[model samples]
Target: MAKKKFIVSALAGILVLGGIGVAAPRHAAAEPVSGGEITYGTQTDPVNWNPHQNNQANAFLYLRNIFDTLLEKTENGDFVPSLAESYSVSDDGTVYTFRLRDGVTFHDGEKLDAAAVKLNLDKANETPYSIYAFPNYDSATVVDDRTVEVRLKKPDASFLDSIAYIGWGIISPKSLTEHLNDLPSGGQNLAGTGPFRISSYQKGAQVVLESFDDYNWAPETKAHQGKAYLDKVTYRFLAEPSSRVGALPAQVDVIEGISALDVSKFKDRDGFVYLSNDANGDTFKLSLNAFLSPLDDVRVRQALRDGFDLDALVKSLYRGEIRRAWSHTSPVSPFYDKSLEGAWGNNVENANKLLDEAGWTERDSEGFRVKDGKRLSVRVLYPTQLDREQRSTLLQGISQQLKQNIGLEFIVDLTPSSTYLKEVASGAVHIYPSTWLHSDVRKSLNGLSNGGALATDNKADPSIQPLKDLAAEALATSDNAQRIKIFHELQRKAVIDDVTYIPLLVQAYQIAASNKVNGLGFINQIGSPEGVYDVWVAK
Candidate 1:
């Protein structure tokens, strides 16, 4: 019954996941005790504090408590009001009206109003970080003190969904002028309207967030009216999965997901409990970075993508726990296009022809192709913390496929967590793999799949321009039926024509905590660690 999906109404402004509302549970209903600091162990440290720029799935471990979105999305894809009291869209769908809560305030003394919404929306649309936020947005108009009328260039049905899920919760009007783009790690210097305040941060080590005493505007679904029970929430970055699991029951109160190999052992452990949910987002993908040379050549990117085997890797490493992804969007998403089931397959003959046609006709004594004095060599880089057998074997297979069949040298490089992003962003690495944790179908329009100058997958390929336009078309058209057509058109281009982004497998986030921890659950946004405000010490 939970799997059934009904057609979404284009004019409807509300989101109802599984046809029900997830009432934000209260502390009194949960195990009751005064308070205790929750030390959370995470896989990696966030590089940026700016929500628009921070793409890591674990970034929410800190930011969720510090910020609140305008609306909440249930795990089943329903939308509920959050920061904004209620919202509605015009018949044409170009204008959206959101009514603000009566007395909401940022951590700073600034008041929350329509002006704050407009300022943040305007800033997000301009920044490269806000790739999916206000995607087709034109301008924001403050209708009144509590009302905001957002005007879009075209009609869009999912614009509210984008707002309901942006990591950049409306910032303090004060912080906009002061902390704009200068925010450091954990966003300790930034101000938000959530139930927690960033108290301290030690850069790559840990971030401490103290509860906001004056916070009472928690969404109506929330069980508590004001002030969180826990006094402090500390997120400690432990890159090693084993290190995080070891910290349990003592050093840390909760640990984010265990290795697949260790899942059974932790399942029945008396002092601990396991929690997991299948993510409705992008799975692990070997981003075919076309910006780098050799790979900058579209045929080479397509050849490499076609030659590798992703199903074998998923079957070998995941053991049926996760399935190989076909489209850039998750299978769980409504926009996912399944016709591309076998669009990319093992094709050594096609791979060889592509290289030969690209004028890599000369072979060195080592049997490697060379054109214009440059060897057909590519480097693969991945974070050390992400080095699981599944990833390790996948890289090895990618290397073997390119080297043995086509004489392309695939050098595998291990990058430390601290400098991984810098190395990937330096444009030196040809192949890098990561996961996208967005619930919105617009995941294809951001980062690697964006296919723009800022996107890693772009390499002056004029073909991607049309797909980008199609993304805007799909986003702006209010009709879900029309969107399905446009979305498939974009997926067809991405999979068969471009082959720039390779979707590997669907994955889940496992949140585990001490048995004493209570009221930890999903938030209405993407990523892990949901509503921390409801969590409290058990008596």
Candidate 2:
């Protein structure tokens, strides 16, 4: 499980009120003047806001403030009850019983009970592409109006962490029934039992949310319980980074996806602060199409892994803001093993030796390696965005370096965001840049090992048996210490064994805020932005 650390004291003393310094107000006693609108900017436009349909982080951040989950993570990285006041796991770790809180109502004014909870879980399980599908759940039983029990097929220690994911947010039973047929596709209606409710939404444009005054079951980590301090939250779509950053100084209260180059520009500004951290959120990596002709050979894959340099790529492109990753697990991930340093730096001699052993000595007049009338080349595909452009340029540079030293030809193929996933899923591309959204290594590794067509590049199947076994063992063990040990071992095997994916960088979570904004804090886990319920702006 990924641990979430909170810095309460870090933001307790920092006061920013309307471009002037103010004394830190007393905790819980200082009632903020509620009834102001906060404008936030994001790079990507959300496809859907409904929890049952959308899985993007930006969409979740908006939905989390409106929909409550059965449980939530604290600053100290512990699981606490949210909709359910308390919960207990069976001795075998397969059965979970939740004791629901009383007097809770959904934004739609429907009562939230055990039946609602069961209905929501059942709907989530039935969804074909849901995150819940990965857990192999059996069924949810309604013990009574305020109590429910969930049974899993196997003992999964990471069940709580998985629940902390964005796709696991609980929805109202009424909404599920109304949109039952559209559940598999996408639903436009937004219904949740969270602190805020959707007042209005414009597809591919903006979403407006109003605080729910009747909300009272806030977790202990929450600073305010009755109502959110802000009257409304307006999330606007700004796909370009330059425009988003420019909007910050113009009084945009909050924004996300700030580039590293702009961090120092706003660091010392008064009344302005940015919350940044190396959360175990996403891992950026390169996926190799093992099913391709030349790549089908293990020695060829090993040679490709040994031929590239990651440190230079990080320094030149990421400006040292992100950490270089050796395994699929990020530094903050519980599964990360410091001992395994993976294939790093340039090793032309070893790469040549591996290729030679694989019987690829023949070379064409152009000086590219050839085997059985086929040229040794690969086409790398990536999203045509600024961040992706930087990564692609770095890959091109690495490929040029490898060609000069080891006689391999590489091509770059940039694709639009809309068609990237479909292209990858159809196996139309070979090399591509991809990311694993979940914090747990098991979930990330399982996607690659399951033999299903990847969202990008379905042409090759990379055998992930080693990773699958590791995930199974980690989830089966009940002991926390033992689970960590097994996870660490799994990461080691992933790095040293030269798996299908090469972990490259761990990008830090960056958010740009205005001088008037307050109450924003760091959540050192996946889907950190969901804690926006605690955020407020001075009136």
Assess the local accuracy of residue 22 in candidate 2 as a C-alpha lDDT between 0 and 100: 11
- Judged by whole-model lDDT over C-alpha atoms, candidate 1 comes out at 0.69
TM-score of each: 0.82, 0.85
Minimal lDDT window, size 10, model 1: 1-10
Displacement of residue 493 (Cα, Å) in model 1 is: 3.1
How many residue pairs in model 2 have overlapping backbones?
A: 5
> Tens-digit lDDT track for model 2 on 1-539?
22122222111111100011111121121345566778888666565555656655545567668777787665445666778787766656677788889999987788999999888888777756354554558899999899898888976655665555556778777777786555333233557788888777666677778888888888765776777877788888787767778888674777777766676666677756766655564367777666665666767766777777767767876676667777666666655667757445467689899899998899999898888888888777777642432466667877887787778887877777667767777765666766655554456546444332232344233455555666666556545566667756655554445446667777456666775677765443463454466676665
Looking at model 1, the pairs that clash are 15-78, 15-79, 16-78, 16-79, 17-78, 24-221, 155-476
How many clashes (backbone atoms < 3 Å, residues ≥3 apart in a chain or on different chains) does model 1 have?
7
